[model samples]
Target chain A: MHLRTPLPPRPRPARTTRRPLKHRARVLLLALCTIGATILVSAPSAQAYAPVEIVHTEQVQVGPYHLTVGFSKWPLRAMQSLDFTFAPDGGLTGKSGILSMTGPGMQGGMHMGGPLSRHPRKRDVWGLDVRSLSTAGQWSFTFTINGPHGQGTGTLDNITILAQPGPPLALSWTLCTLPVIGLIAFLVVAWRRHRPSRHLTVVGI
Target chain B: MDSVHAPTLTGPGQPSPPDHPPRPQPAGAAGAYTVLAGTLMSLVGVSWDVQWHVDVGPDTFFTLSHLMLYCGSAIAGIASLVMVLRATFAGRVGRPADPTVGGSPVRVFGGTFTAPLGYLVAGTGAALFLLYGLMDLWWHSLYGFDAVLNSPPHVALFISISLTMVGSVIVFAAARAQRWGRIGLVVSIPVLITFTPITTNAFNGVSPAIDPQLAGTVLFAVCFILMGGITLRRRGVALSIAAVLGVMQLFLWWFSPWAAKAYAAHVGLPLRDNLRHMPPQLPSGIPMFMLAAALVIEALLRLGRRRGWSGRWLPQLTGAVGGVVLSFSMLVQTSMLRGGAGAGPMGPSTTSATTVLTDAILGLAFGALAGYLAARFAVLLHLNAPATDQEGR
Candidate 1:
C-alpha cells in the first residue's frame, strides 16, 4: 500500500516573501488613507458657518397636496442664515408656489402670502436662500401652490426658535474695551517714562 | 547728546565717507516702510471681511473686502518684488549687498536672483498668498454659496499675509539705527496682533475644559506688551501703539456695521444682525489692555533697573504679576464675545466663580512663560539704542 502511493501532483510553492501579500497590504493601507481623508474633509464640526443644505424637514398636508418643508439647520435659532425648502412629493413640473413668512406676533392670512421662489442651492424645491429669522419666537410660513390639480394653500405654523447664537454683539464689544481702558489708565500713570531726559538726545529724522 | 554712526560697514574697494554727516538710512529703507503701509491696508481689509460675513451673509470671492485684501497684498507683493529684483541686478553687477539685508543679500535660484532678507520673505509670502487667493476661488467654485468660515484656503491666506508682515518687521529691525527705521518699528508694533486671531481660532478645536482663549489672549497680551516696554525702553511707546490700535479698532467699529448695513440696503440683502451689532471676531478690546500691560512692564523695568534685577526669569516674573490684570480683562472680553457682548445673560458675573478663577490662574502661569520668550525676542531685535527721535526736527 505504501509503494502504491502516488507522487503529489505539484510541489508546494516556496514560502519566501512574495508580492501578493505585500500588494494586498499596500492596497489596504491606501484604502484606509482614502477613508480617513474623506472623513476629515467631510466631518461636520462647529464650522465658521455652514452651507445651505437641507438636513431635516417638516411635513404639511393641505387638500390634495403633501408638502415637505426643509431647513438647512435644525433647532432653529434667531438671526441665523438658513435655507428653507418646500417640496411636493409629486414633483415641480406643473406647480407654482408663493410663500409668506409671518413673525412671532403676526397674523396669518391670504393677503400675507406670495409666490415661492426656487432655492439657489436646492434647485429641485421652491425655497428661500440664506434667509434669517430676526427674532426668537414662534414663526409660521404660509405656502400657496398652484398646479394642474388645482390651487391649494397650507400653513406650517408654530416653529420654535432659540435665541441668537454667540455673545451679545454690543455688550461683547463694550467688554472688549474694558481691558484697553485699564491699559490707558496705566499708561497715563506711567507717562513720566517718556519725559525729556538730559542723556536723551531727540534725534532729528 | 547726539552722535552719528561711525562707519562700521567700511570695507576695502568701497567708496570713502564724505566729510559731511550722512542721513541714518539704508538704501532699502523705503521698501521696508512701504511694506509696513501695505500691511496696514491689508489688516483693515481682513477685519472688514469678518464684519461682512456676519452682517451681509455669505460672500463670493469678488466681494469688496476681498478686493481690498487682494489689492493690499498686491501693493506689498509688488514692492517686495521690485526691491528683490533691484538687489539681484545690483548683486549681479558686482555691487556689495545692501546693509539693511544684514550686510549681505541672500542668493536665490542658483545665484540667478539675490535679494534682501526682508524683501525675499515678503515676496515669498505675497506669492504664496496669491496662490491661496486662486485656491479660494476654486473652493468657492466647488462649494458654491455659504462655505465654512475657517476653510483651508482662508487659513493659508492668513499665514501667507503674516509671513509678509514678518518680512516687513525684519527690514525695519535690520536698520534700527536709522531715524526712519525707529519710526517704522514703532508703526509696525501693532502687527503683533495677528497672533491673537490665529491663537483665538484654537478655541474652536480645543475643549472648554482647557479654556484655550485664555492662552491666546494671555500670550498675545503679555508677551507683546512686555516686549514693547523692554525693547523700546519707553512707557509711552506701548501706549502710543495701543492708541493707534484702538483708533483702528474704533474705525472698524464704525466702518464694519455701517458698511454692512449700507451694503445690505444697497444690495437688497438683509442685515439681520442689526440688534446688538456683530460680535467682533478679531481682538476687539485686547490691544487696549496692552496700554495697561505696557505701563506695568515699564514700572517693573524701572524697579528692576533700580534693584539691578537681570536674568531670564525677570521678564517671566514681571509677566506673571501683570498677567493677572490682563487675564481678568480677557475673561471680560470672552464673556462679551461668547455671550453676545452685553445682550446675552451669561456675562462674567453669571459664570461660576470657580471657573473664572481657574482661567485666571492658568492664564497668569502661561503669561509668565510667554513673557520670558517675548522678552528674549525683543532683546534680539533691539539692534539699536532706544532713542527719542523726531521726524523733521
Candidate 2:
C-alpha cells in the first residue's frame, strides 16, 4: 500500500460574491446592435420617380394575326426608351425590347415632330419595331414601361402575338428560399457548438 | 497476537467518487424548443378559418382573441405538464445510465432530420404559390375566372413538392455519408419554399373561381404542421407530446361547440335590446379557464415533487390534469372546424385578435398535455422494448 503525502501549500485568491455588471452591459449592447442592423439590411429597394402615363396602342393586322403597341413619356430626344414582348396568351414575355433613335441629331428631332410636320404635339415620337407577331386568333399585346419613373403594365386587345402550346410550369423562386436559409443557420450553430476546446490536466507521476 | 490480527483484518471503507461531468446538451436544442412553440402558435389560424357557435341563439357572443389565447395556453400548458412530471420523476425512478436511450444517436439524427422537414414544408408552400401563378397567367391570358384557384395554387404546390424532394434526398444522403453540405441543402430548401410564396402574388388565387381565403388557410396549415414537425422531431419526446395534444385537440375540435357570449348594455334602447347581433357562437371563456387550470396543476405537482412530497394523489392528479386538457382541446378544435353558429368572417376582420390569443394559450395548454402523454408513453415503451429485444436478460 502507498502512503498518503501532503502537497505544498497553494495560494488562493480573494473571491467576491457580487455579480458582474460589465458583462451584463456588454450583452445588452450586443443585442441592441443586432436589432438595429437587422432593420437596416432588410428595408425595401428604392424606386425612381417620373411623370409618365400609359397611352393607347396602335393595332396592325397581317393575314390572320394582329399587333398592338403604345408608349408614353418616352424621351426620344433624351435617348431614354421603353419596350415589351408578347406571349401566346397575350401576356408579357421575357424583358421588353428597348426603343432607340439612330443618331444624336436624329434623336433630338424625334421629339420635335414627324418629317416636315414638325408639330410639337407629335414630339417624343419614339418607335418600337415589334420583332414579330406569333400567336393567331384574337390576340392581345400588353406594354410594360420602365423608365426614369416607376414601371407600369397596360394591355390592349385584338392584337396577335407569337403562339406556342405552353411552357412547363416552373417553381416559384421565393418559396424555395425559406428552407435553404433555415438549414444553413442550423448547421452554422451546430458547428460553433461542437468546436474543440483547450484545457489543462494534471498528470500523475 | 490474535487480538492484534483481528484489528488488522478490518479494512478501510471506500470513499465515494466525484460526480460525473454534466451531460452535454444537444446543439441548437433550445432553438428547437422555440421553433416548436412558434409552430403551434400558428395553429391560431384555425379559428380565423371557421367560426364557433353554441346550441343557443345567434349573436350571443363572438371574438377571435379568445380562441388564440386558448390555443397558445393549451400548447404551453401541455409542455409544462410533461416537463414537470419528468423532472419530478427523474429522481425517484432513476434508471441506470443507458447511453443508447437518448444520447448521440438522437442528437445526430435530429440535426439531420430538421432540414428535410423544413424542405418539405417549403416545397408544399411553393407548390401552392405556383398554383396561383398559373391562375394569374391563365386569368390574364383567357380573361376568365376558371384559372383562378386551380391555376395559381398549382404553382405553389409544384414548388413545395420539388423542394421537398430535393431536401429529402439531401437529408438522406447526409445521414448515410455524414456530409455537412447536406445540412445546408436541407435548410435552404424549406426557407425558400415558404418565403417565396408570400413574396410573390403567384399564390394569390383570390378570384371568383377559387376561395382565396380557404386556399390561404390550407397553405398556412400545411406550412405550420410540416415545420412544426421538423422542430418537434429534433427535440424528440417534447415535440411528441405537442403532437399528441395537437392530435387529441383535433378530436375535440371536430366535436365541441366553441362558445362565446358578448353582452352590450346601453341606455339608448331601454334594457338590453340595443345589442348588435354578431353570431350564434358565445365566447364561453372555458378554454382560457381550462388552460389556466392545466398550468396551475402542473406547477403545483412540480413544486410538490421538488419538496419531496410524493403520494398516490400525485399520479392521480397528473392523470386528471392531462385528461381535462386533452378533452377540452379536442372539443374546441372539433367545434370550430366543423362550422357551428359562429363560423365565417366576423365582419371586417378576417383574422380576429381573439383567435391569436386563444391559439397561443391553447397551444401551450395542449403542448403540456402532449408532453405528459409522451413521457408516460416513452417510459412504457422503454420498459416494453427491452423484453422483446433480449430474451432472459
Candidate 3:
C-alpha cells in the first residue's frame, strides 16, 4: 500500500550578507568621527565663558531652611555688618534674625584685595529665623558693606529655599548583602566540613 | 566542503554512515563570557558617571542607595559588551554557533546601527545634563561658571560623553548586521540616560518648586516599570535586579518619615523645620517601593544562571528576585533604626509603622503583578527569543 507524504513548511528568507569592514579600519574611523563631533558640540559652550568672570552667591543651610544671599560680581566677605528682612508672603511672618560672621580669608579670586587689616574684629552677617517656609517665593536681603575702603550697599535678590529631605529608602544594605550572604554561606559550609573532618577521623580499634 | 565534512567520522570507518548528523559542534562559551563582561562594565559607567546620587528621605523617589546603582550598571554593561563583542568575533574563526544563543540570523547592520544610535542619543544627553549640573553648581557656589573645579569638569564630561557617543554610534553602525545587535541595544541605555534632565528651573534659582524627592521617586518608578517590561522581553538577569529595586523603593517610602526622623533625631535636626522646606506631603508612604520592585525583578532574572539556563531569560529573573529581597530588608532596617528618640536625634511620629507596612504590601503586590504582566506581555507580543528551528538565517 502506498502512503501520501506531507510537505514541509516553507523556510524563511535567508539573512542578507555584506563584506564587513576590517576592525582596525572601523576603530580608526570611529575615533576620527568622535573627535570631529566633540569639537562641534563643545566649541560654542567654551566660548560662552570666555571672559572668565567669577559669579558669587552666598548660601547657608541652617536646619530645614535655605538662605541664599544672592548673586554678586564682587566678594562680600569684606563686609563687617549685614542686615536683612523678609516681606510677608508664604511662610515667614515678618521674621528676621542676625548672624555674626568670622572666618579665614575667603580663598579663590583676587577680586577681594589683600589680607584683611591685621585688626582683630567680629563681623556681623545678617540672619533670618526662617522657622517655617510655608510660602514658595523669593526673599530679598540688602547688605550695608562697612569695609575699610568705604561703605557700599548691595542687594541680594530671589534667595530660594527648598524644603525636602533625603530619599526615604536606602538600598545600600541590600547591595552589601549579596556579598555578605555569599560569605556567610561559605563560612557555614566550611565549618560543617572542617568540623566533621577533624572530629571523625577513625580511632585505632 | 569535503575537507570540512571529513572530520566527523570517529574511526577509519568500515562503512561511513550515510547521514551522520553533523557532529554536535563545540559551542561558543568564550564569546558568551566576553559579552557578559562587557555588559557589566558598560552598566557601571552609565549608572555612576551619568546619574550621581541625590539625597532625599522617604518623601523623595526610590532610593538610589549610594553609588551601587551606577556601579551595578557599569558592571553589567561592560561585561555584556565584552562577551557579545568577543562572541561576534568568534564567528570569524569558524567556531560553531551555540544552538541556544544564535537564533534568528540578524543582519549585523540593523542590530549594530540601532543600538549605537540609541547610545549616542543617551550618552550625549547625559553629558549635557552633567554639564548643566556643573553649571548649576557653579552658579550656586561661585554665582557663575568660571571656577576651575566646577567649569572644567563640566566641559570635560560634556565633550567626553559626546565624543564617546559618536564613537559608539560608528562602532555600532560599522558592526551592524553582526550577532551583537541585541547586545548593542542593551548598551545604548546609558546613552539614553545621559539625555534625561535630572534638574530643572534656573530662573527661579537652583531650588526646585517641584520637590526633587517626589520627582526622583516617580522617575525611579517609571524606570522600574520599563526595566520590568524590558526583562520580560529579554528574559535574563536584568529582571532580578529590577525586582530588588522595586522592593527597595517600597521600603524607603514606607519608612521615610521614620528614617528622616531618625536621621534628624540622631543628628539632632528639627523635623517640622526640615519637612517644611520640602514639597507638600503626598499619600506615598515609601518612595523606594517601586525601585525595590525593579531590583527584585532583576535579581530573579539572574537566578536562571544557577540553573544551567544561559540565555536572555536568566538576567531578568535573577535581577528581579535579588533586587527586591535586598531592597525590602534594607528599608525595614532603616525604618526600625530611625523610629525612636532613643535611637537617634529625631522623634518617631505616628505615621511611621502604618507608612512602612503600606509601602511594603504595595511594593510586594506591584512587583509580583509587574513580573506576571511582563511575562504575559512577552508571550502576547511574541517577544520570545526565536527557537533555532524557527529562526531565519
Q: Estimate TM-scores for all models.
A: 0.62, 0.23, 0.34
lDDT of candidate 2? Answer: 0.30
Identify the leading candidate in terms of DockQ: 3
- DockQ of predictions, in order shown: 0.02, 0.02, 0.03
Best model per lDDT: 1
TM-score of chain A of each: 0.56, 0.19, 0.23
- Decide which is better by DockQ, 1 or 3: 3
Model 2 spans with C-alpha error above 4 angstroms: A1-82, A85-136, A140-157, A165-205, B1-196, B199-209, B212-214, B217-393
Q: Rank the candidates by TM-score, best first.
A: 1, 3, 2
lDDT of each: 0.60, 0.30, 0.32
Model 3 steric clash total: 177
Give the Cα error of residue B279 in candidate 2, in Å. 32
lDDT of 1 at B249: 67
TM-score of chain B of each: 0.82, 0.25, 0.32
Residues A59-92, model 2: lDDT tens digits = 5432222334454422111111222212212322
lDDT, candidate 1, B1-393, per-residue tens: 111122322222233423333245545676777788788778877777777765556465556766688777778887887787777566546575544442235555434456665676677677667656655554443334443444455656776777677667657655655556656766676664643565255246547566665676677667765665555555466566666666666676677667766766776565532234345655364444556665666677678756867554667888887777777766665566557444653332355688678867876797798667666555433322222111212
| Stretch of 10 with least lDDT, candidate 3 chain A | A114-123
